[model samples]
Target: MPNAIEFLFDVGSPTAYLAWHRLQGIVARTGAALIPVPILLGGVFKATGGSPPGTVAAKGRWMNEDMQRWAARDGVVLAMNPYFPINTLTMMRVLAGLEGDSRFGGVVNTLFAGMWQQGLNMADTQVLTGVLTAGGHDAHGLLALAQSPDVKARLIANTEAAVALGVFGAPTCFVAGQMHFGQDRLDWVEAAAAG
Candidate 1:
């Protein structure tokens, strides 16, 4: 069986972006299937009784610098997203639609670039439509699908499933059933994959 790596992420997370960038190389080296699981960090925080970084000044301040260092090392341009920590419902919905897509990686990369590097307001219908269409997905149908009751339920279920898996933040990586959280933990993740 092919090794699987499940990645739970939210777009508002710089950590997620950093981890996302790092995963490509890890997948190549380890030959693990990259599985992206979209989950809401805000909801996860609530479920885990945690608060956003801004609510805790000391750690938040340190994380800001840490993020820059990781971005520099990873070579992923780290421009602060203008609309960040923006609601990722639409982004997640779009990604969920791509879960089974043949162009999954392309779609994920485009969404990350659009929201993080390009500073597009991901919540904007037109912006999302454009991103999907540009990526060759049906924009109009996706927009409607994103708002459908079924999609909403699935997104919530996604978050609940993440919580059940003991996820408390974005960028949680599950390798061979062992969980590794954060970009700083890549070494252990790689080890898990190797073993």
Candidate 2:
């Protein structure tokens, strides 16, 4: 097996949501392992001097349109959440907690779907716990683990690592040590994987 593709993402980013939806096909076709690294987007922004797309009104508007089209084409739901800038720390830590659990992958997939497709606010404790429980995890246990100091530190460390790696955006794919930002660059990611 080849080295896994390191997928750095934050749940609050629509771009990351789009990439998450598209990644399943890429992993299947390329036979590449997917290493999901959930980070705080704000931390990444601070560390990398990157600005969120929403800062640019014109660009952000067009991006939302493009994203809607793409999501529809891919058969993924794209309901815009009212919480444009939701705090993702809670959700990220929960994801980190699922790291070694047998339910890790399932929880990740379902939670992403819950946010991007179902418009669920993952930051809310009730919503998070419900999603985890529905996905067959011990919600209370997972939440307790997620809230631990270790998980919080690791999430921060992950954000710092992404910045150190020169990643300035969400949905960045690190394949063969080269960073490919955005779903539009999946072709390049595929080429890199092919070799």
Candidate 3:
């Protein structure tokens, strides 16, 4: 068996959501622990000179189509959020704040579904609160924690560490010290874990 798989991801990326959806089964089969590392995609972009897919019109359209095809292949529901490129600073901070909490996984699931399945405007604080409440999280407390300096610093550190590790985008995975970027490379991730 391999070491724990590190999943460095941002919620704003639908491909990351797709990776999250498939990780559980992969881990179950491979007996590898799945570690979720919340990183700000924007920070990674800035550090790595990368930009979001929406920056290019044709690429954006093709990417959406590709996401749809992958969703169909994986039997996962993915509705493109109308508010594309929603600023994820607050969300990532909240995730960092909840880093070691038992409810972290639940929060991750709720937020991912809210963004990629329910098409919620995750950039809006009110909308985020409602989604979190509906998901049974303590929205007020979580939001409060998200604003703390510690959480912000943790997120920044995570993003910087990811960049230092050669990550340039969301859904970057590390299995057995081998890096795999993008949801399309999940097969490689499984193989690495199985070895």
Which candidate number maximizes lDDT? Answer: 3
lDDT of 2 at 133: 84
Please identify model 1 stretches exceeding 4 Å from their true place. Answer: 134-137
User: Residues 1-195, candidate 2, lDDT per residue (tens digit)?
Assistant: 555678888878887887877888888888888888887888888876778887799988898899998888888788887666777788888777666667767877777777777788778889888887887778899789887999988888888888889888888999888899987787787767655
Using TM-score, give the best candidate's number. 3
- For residues 1-195, write the lDDT of model 1, one tens digit per residue: 446788888877878888888988988888877888888788899899976675577987788788888888888887767676687778787666666777667777777877777878877878877887887877787677667777777778989999998988878989888999887998888778766
lDDT of 3 at 105: 94
TM-score for all predictions? 0.89, 0.91, 0.97
* Model 1 score (lDDT): 0.80
lDDT of 1 at 52: 65
Cα-based lDDT at residue 54, candidate 1: 52
Q: Write the per-residue lDDT of candidate 3 for residues 1-195, one digit (tens) a residue.
A: 466889999999999999998898899899988889999999999998999987999999999999999999999999999998899999999999888788899999999999999998999999999999999999999999999999999999999999999999999999878999999999999889888
| Model 2's TM-score against the true structure | 0.91
Best first by lDDT, ranked:
3, 2, 1
Error of 3 at 41 (Å): 0.3
RMSD list, candidates in order: 2.0, 1.7, 0.9
Q: What lDDT would each prediction earn against the true structure?
A: 0.80, 0.81, 0.93
Output the better candidate (1/3) by lDDT: 3
Q: lDDT: which is higher, 1 or 2? A: 2
Rate residue 129 of model 3 by lDDT. 99
